[model samples]
Target chain A: MSRNLFDMVWDMHKVATLSTGQDQLFIGLHLVHEVTSPQAFAMLAERGLKVLYPGRTFATVDHIVPTDDRSRPFSDPLAEEMLGAIERNVRAHGIEFFGLDSGNQGIVHIIGPELGLTQPGMTIACGDSHTATHGAFGSIAFGIGTSQVRDVLATQTMALDRPKVRLVRLDGKLGTGVTAKDLILRIMAELGVDGGLGYAYEYGGAAIAALSMEERMTVCNMSVEGGARAGYINPDDTTVEYLRGLPYAPSGEGFEKAAAFWKSLASGPGSSYDDEVGIDASSIEPMVTWGINPGQGIGISGRLPRLEDLEGAERDLAAKAYEHMKFTPGDPVKGRKVDVAFIGSCTNGRISDLRAAAAVAKGRKVARGVRALVVPGSKRVAAQARAEGLDLIFLEAGFEFREAGCSMCLAMNPDKLLGDEVSASSSNRNFIGRQGSPTGRTLLMSPAMVAAAAVSGEVVDVRDFV
Target chain B: MTITPIRSLAAGRGIPIRENDIDTDRIIPARYMKGITFEGLGEFAFHDARFDEAGNPKAHPFDDPRFKGGSILVVNRNFGCGSSREHAPQALEKFGIRAIVGESFAEIFAGNCTVMGLPAVSASGPDVAALQDLIEAKPETEIRVDLEAMRVGAGNLDFGISMKDSYRNALVSGTWDSTAALLSNLDAIRAVASALPYIGGFA
Candidate 1:
């Protein structure tokens, strides 16, 4: 039997074998958001069910909260109503909520870790797909639908089939300017979009261990893009160190005990995985998604694949991408002019991401025609960036520094692309109209690359910034 | 806690969406999900993909008159690939998609369909391609998905389909609405939670 962290955590939470042959898994942490929770709450009310374990659930507003002008009764009535629903629901259920004035509010994935609520060996569930971002802390976290959210609320457990574990080991170290974003993009590219369909990815090896907690999050955040519902790294000293002194984490002796328990959950010698795949990290370059899906990516120095180079479904999707993006196959990816530049999302909106972007924007000005925006993932991240003067650097460079929210990533709020504008975005997902405009184009890259594109007015390599 | 058992889907007209990796955003754009409830989402299903900024109808299968009132959706590989938004499947369900036949589906999307009592079944690539072609060629052809028989039938053609056995069981047994089944084991859940070191702060 597989003895990895995923298997162990899964077994620990397995409540019973349901009639359908699925395991009834107890959810340790249930994160809720504005967009997907209201209907679930309504369903619970209709069923006359009360929240089974209110303390285990946490709520926040991100999907529809306006990153700019976040005053009451948001200019958008629907957005305001959605926010109100969450506020009322959390209050009624006694679930802790990090609202606008809470000073802890942010993207659900970002706040979960920053507040220390996301810990090792815990099974976390959220309605948003990016919930896999929590897996960086060695937790088993995955996204669920509204009905599953209702189940987690009414019963504190969900019926799920166990997914096999795929050990994705990355050897060597990433080169300068090649970030965790690039590492994950390359993994998605090699694995295709549905490669991890029924598997949970256990990311390990020297390169994974070398990544900081935020960097690891960036890697695990996009696990869903490669079709893995959950991805995680084994807890180590770095994991413990990052959790130390956080608001929700245990303190002093309790923390030491927690740390030992966390370390014990790591897959040890002779542990086996269902499958193993290894890649050399040093070979990966800064990646950019040229197509709608996250898998349609290439290294910064590479050119788009020609039609004749692909076959079957791959060829068909490439043909569609070329027509939709209006880019010729076999053309160089660099020097493509961009109209907007966005830096923020659950994927790359933390303090570290802002610092990396600021380092690039320090002595540069945004291109004359480009509109750039920097959105922190949470209020805490924004405060930390301001304290470090990263906001000043971005503002001086002509980038609009806005309040923390999902922002241009999903474009549920007012932040959106206009017309057929092309954007260099740090947010995950370049799906058609994902940036809020059906014709708008997005080039997925790291925060630094987004900064470089903002300054150069085109798709340029971040390595050139140095 | 009760749900309608979905043992098999009766013959119905199929809508062909022959494309690989059709993401959830394309099914229902994020803007339309701003509403508090999934009500009235059917009209907005595939909103951006079927209409231009000016609200002019685009050349989409959903807008094509031939596929009007289609209850089954025939698609290519990796359908519903991005974003775990239940709105995507809910939009399709509200738009009258009772069952989905595709080459493959994202795990979360398929799971969402199951809980909602909608069946998202899969077949071989060639089988799916042929089915899509058949649907496009004759939009009035009746298609039936039989979970008990593990096959899809239309005219004299029969294609073997597969789904997660657990999902099939849940649907066939009307246990797809799993909240009741999970809640029934509260004692076991409490026992498991108490034994876990993290739940009690590892003290």
Candidate 2:
């Protein structure tokens, strides 16, 4: 039977169908991290089930690892123990682990593509919501829970019902100053957080094609934020070129053959979709989340929406969002005073995002009492940023340049927000207490916008700073 | 798993908190969230934080002993927000919470509690207020949650809870297998898809 890329890939990875009608998808790649994998690996030990596909699994430590002061004993005893647990688990299982000593360690999502472990047409699973970040390489990647993590480790397969497909087409070009972060925020705002329920999104169209692999990673990383099961782009020269010269990518003639197969995974020209959404790229602006969920967003220049202006579930969410964000309806998101300004996370913490933020902070000083931090998405990115003197620019501008890890992004590490501090953040998710303090507030924006807010001590348009 | 809605009541201040969405981090904190059974987690609830730097519950409500004896916990929406760690609720249950009442709970939080037999009651508007009043008026007040009737009564206050019929039925019937239910209809789904006029290549 004729099939779309998604269908062909799904068939390629299927192990069996359960009585529940969900296909038992055989994971071609499994990624693990310190935070969620310890218990899963322990569970495997308890069950005495060796990993069926050890070669397919790769492990790293990111969350809870201190970005500054890399030493034997960690300040947070719990973080130290968690790291030790991961080390023990991986060692016991005889799996490849990219430890701090390896110099190859970073965020699980970041390291995947940087190391070329994420490849086109592969079914990837990880114990992280941002596992979808790997889908940028034209892979079918999704995050699995801890128990499901165990399933993948033990049998390398998971029982998941096939999601209906949603075709999202964004045509034309993004305006200047618009980035992938804005594109995704715009999509979430248009679709609402739950818009993609029970569906996998095939992101197509000229705008997606125009994005670099890093940019695509930023987009697919937030697929979960849009409630899509997963999101992906088609394999093209960009995908192949990005994978080439990477540490783990097949080399020589083997790579050439793989590239051909990868190119074949593109959706056929006439392929149909269950649900389709067409968006004009011009319609999307540099967007930011004004309220709790990612969907409660508008253009950076736009005003917060009145609750009544929404309909059905949207209205209810708007009301709740207002209550949680403690913001009056119809207020301007710009110029909102911020005590903290963060410009990092897997969402928008890539090297390019760092460059944008540094450019914004150039020759400018941070606002008094405003604490700003610049964390690279990976160790490699961190080294490169230092080589480019991006770190020096940030430091001179009064921002703390820390080593790489998922810092402040979740505060599982030492980096955290004090009570009730309102922060302008480049990281996604402005949910209640998401930044650590129960009453702490977070405003999600682009890295450059965060830099502007850090210097101004309030939300300022990055376009003006530029 | 079957989930029953329970009317959430309000009680605050000096109450021992069985905080909703108590993930392994908050309940046991990351330091002690690992290793042993959840048996000792109750005493360790907010171990690193119960008191605070000054040994007080300034912002954290975990140290409030007033809500300690209350079987029901009133909570904020999306009570379980971060992490898929089930140990959060495990510590709460170990701390002696039998049920949680909130505007809504996280999908993972509710699922974990279901497996552990901890009932999460979802309430709305007025019913939420009545529960609050009842709990505040009597610290040790116990509210019985009736999944079949979808109601909670404490003293003179009565509250109604709503959930999907399938979920309610599952709670009442002691079968909370949503996946099994979906699976049972696979043949029917196939039949319907085949019967559809234009759903080609779907199955």
Candidate 3:
């Protein structure tokens, strides 16, 4: 029987089927960070259980770590306590810790791939939602709750019901200035936020296959926003090349053997899908979210959705979004004022993402009254960007170049938007108050689009500036 | 380590929220997640929608006196549509909501609810609308969710609910406890881990 890549990897990882009928899937890697793991570790301790397979687990402090200052004893007591707890827990459990000073420390999703810890034909679990970022390597990665995290720590496995596979095929080439971020935003807008429920999205076709590894990561990173349990691009030469020399990757002839094994895991030509959706990459433009959710998006030049065109619950949601966003139906998304422009997150914080943003920020100055920031996804990403002088380019354009952390993404740290301040962000989620203030508004866009917003002081097409 | 089986929930008053796509953010805002524990989250559930800027009470459904002690929440399509935060279900579970019947639910949110022993069942859009109307018409009327029969009923109105067989069996047999399942398969898990080259080395 022909099977898609999702089923292939899932079947490979199946350890047992419990009497409850859930598959006991072995996790090849488990990533943890400060915010979610402390409670999980505490839960394990309450049960008097040690980490069953500490070798498969890795820890880092990202979510609550302050981007501006790296010194210990953070200003936020809760943040400090959470970091302390993870540090102690990882040390006691014999799990690898990528601490604040570990140069490898960054967002858990970013560090995993860059270190080659995320590999094809593997089942990776994390306590963070963006674990789908590792799916770029053709791994089956999904976010789990703290209790599930405890289960993984204590048994190196998790119980899950298999999800049906949906093929999201993107053919043709992306137009100039369009990015993987734009592609995903366009997909979410077309599919609606809840379209991928109960399905594992297998992203493929010419456009997806053409994307660079970092770009692929950006595309897979936002799969959760579209309600997919997981999303993956099948392993190919691009994936193999990206993993070749990473610190944790296999070396020399072992690399060749691993790559061959990975190649075999791709869906065969006769593979079938439960459902398939075709998208023309050329039809997409520089996309931006105008409303509260990631699905409430339009092309930079497109107008807001008309409420009259929608019906029932969708109409109500659009109305609520318009009221919350202060955007009028049929109005252009371009020229909307932005108070802040943020360029970073696990979504678009790679070296390539920084280079793209720097290209837009090189010659122009940020518009007066607009506060812009450039945060790297990982310490290694930060170092690479600095070596290439991307930091200087951003700094010269009046953007604050900060340390590596999940800054302002959830605003668990000090960096946050003031009340009702509208921001142009390159992060994944645009949920209400996601950027800090109770009513702060976030418009999700590409990193270059964020740079364009910084210079224009409003949402604008990145193609116009580039 | 066994979870208590929840085959059937007792009949109870149902609260109706006519809104669709009530995301996790609206359930419990991100700022409230800074705490180490989930304690006291019940007070802040729907904090923004339930209160005005000056901390005055608003006309949100959770704030209505009629639904103060409602144990069942009937909602519209795509309830809990954003974020994978378990806190959303935790807050709902703490806020006296024992069961949720909606037009649909986000997959992760539904999974989170199952883990918390709060059953989130789905029905058709018209059936959900009818359920909401029934609840609004008689807020004190008792509604029962029968997992065994895969139906929810209130008076003469009953709607068929759908859930995955695995999730249904887990909820009914108390095997929803993932910890217990993991422990039972520990030896198999170790064997799998030991076979992987990456896990064998690097420690």
Candidate 4:
């Protein structure tokens, strides 16, 4: 019998079934970042344990790094302290460190793929939720908490309960101005935020195959937002070609052998799935989240759902969103004024995202009184953006071309919102106070939509520019 | 590290959060998460909801005088949905939440809770709602969560609750730490890694 990529990879990595009825699975790649690793490292010290496989674990600084200044000491003492903790811990454990000086430093999710550390048919674990971003390469990658991080460090494995599989098949092709971001938002809206609780999503079909590697990453990156522990796309020419000649990828004859193995991991023709959800790709439009969660999104031409249209928990959440966002039910979201426009995160911070934003920002001035910021996902992304002069385009448009880091995505650094400023953001998670200020609001959209919002000083359709 | 067996949580006062989709950002804001450790995070649990910009107390259940010492948290569906921050569970645990009874929970959040020896159990929507109503009607109502029996009791009401069997087993067997159990299979882990093409560099 043929099996899907998830089952194949999961079975290959299963070390043992423990007495507790959980599988003790081996982790092929363990990615670590500053904010979540410090405590895990401390736990290791407290328990007198060392990293089981130092080489398999990679460390980077992202969440608390200051994108504005790469200076030695971050102005925020706590941020500097957190960075110091990771640096010391990595040094002690002999793990590879990607600091600002490494040129590979960016978000952990971005560097993992760009460096070829993320590959097909492997199990990847990270302390960050968006770690599912690695699944674009046909891997079973999921995020874990700090304790699990400690477990991965002390042992090369962690215990996990198996999740059933859901095949999210996207048919047809996306229309102009409709991107992977839009398609994913549409999927999340159709399936409630908690829709994927006990399942891993396998994205397939012609539409998924049509997406570029970066676009596929964007789709998988937000799987956690939909409550899926992990999401993945099967390996094909696009997946393997994206890994070609990368620093960490196998080379020459080894590459040939690895590519063949990866392709074989794809779901076979007769592969079975526990459930299947079909989506019409062409029907999706550029999406913008109207409420506190990513699932509370509507198309660019749509209006906020009236309270009466929603019922039960949905209605209660919508009422809370209206009260928090100061939005009127049935009011059109278009032309809603934005105080800030942010473009960057593991969700939409790839080089393609920057290029798309630059395409809209070129020769277009940001509206007066709008604070626009363009942050790359990684140092390499920033370098690539500079090579293509995307940075110049954004800078000329009155957007702050900042260094690579998480930046304003979660606002762990100095960059944050003031008062009740409304923002148009390309990052995932528009949860309440997600971008910093307790009262600040976030409207999640694609990078181009963010650029359009910045230029027009309000929520505008990106298709208008096209 | 010594492991502690957590069979059940005894009857205690309950805190009812009558909202849905209360994410990690709301449980503990991003600014407070910058610390290197999870220590002192209890004071910041539900910081934004329990306090205003000026730090004044808000009309939140966690802050109510009646539920001051509440050890069981009763919530609506999809609680702890965003950001796989362990700090969310850490904050709640430190804030004295020994068990959580909700209509449902986000996958990662529930797993994180399990690893920390905190049981995140689920019940039918009506059962959860009835429990919350009972707690609110009488703030002094005692709530108990029994992982061994797979049930939750509030005041005069007893209802069936559900959690992953693995989680329940780990809690009862005092192996919730998992690191010891996982490490015991180190040789098998190495054998599996050796068989993987990628791990061997496809050579």
Residue-wise lDDT of candidate 2 within B54-119, one digit each (tens)? 454545444455565555666644565444455667677777676677766654455456534566
The candidate scoring highest on lDDT is 1
- Candidate rank order under lDDT: 1, 4, 3, 2
TM-score of each: 0.99, 0.78, 0.97, 0.99
Q: What is the Å distance of residue B39 in model 3 from its true position?
A: 2.0
- Mind giving the per-residue lDDT tens digits that candidate 3 earns over B99-197? 899888888788888777788888998888888888778787799998988999897898899987787887887767678767887678767767765
Per-residue lDDT of model 3, residues A16-85, tens digit only: 9987787899999999887767778888888899998798899898888889977878888878878878
* lDDT, residue A346, model 3: 94
**Residue by residue across B103-177, what tens digits does model 1's lDDT show?**
999999999999998999999988887888888888899999998898999765698999999999998887798
- Angstrom error of the Cα, residue B3, model 4: value is 4.7
The per-model DockQ list reads: 0.91, 0.08, 0.55, 0.89
Candidate 4 runs further than 4 Å off? B1-3
lDDT of 2 by residue, A1-466 (tens): 3466678778777655554344666677799988767767776677566876677789988888888897978877777888888888788788899998887888888888889888888888887767778888778887765666777777767656677888889999998888888899999888866577557888989999999998999888888777675888889999999988898888777788788888988888888788999889877777778776777788878888887787855676677667757788888888778999998888877888999999999999999999999989888888889999999999999999998888887777878888878888888777655676655778888898889999999887777876
Candidate with better lDDT, 1 vs 2:
1
In order of DockQ, best first, we have: 1, 4, 3, 2
lDDT, residue A92, candidate 3 = 94
Question: Who is ahead in TM-score, 1 or 3?
Answer: 1
**True interface contacts reproduced, per candidate:** 0.93, 0.03, 0.51, 0.89
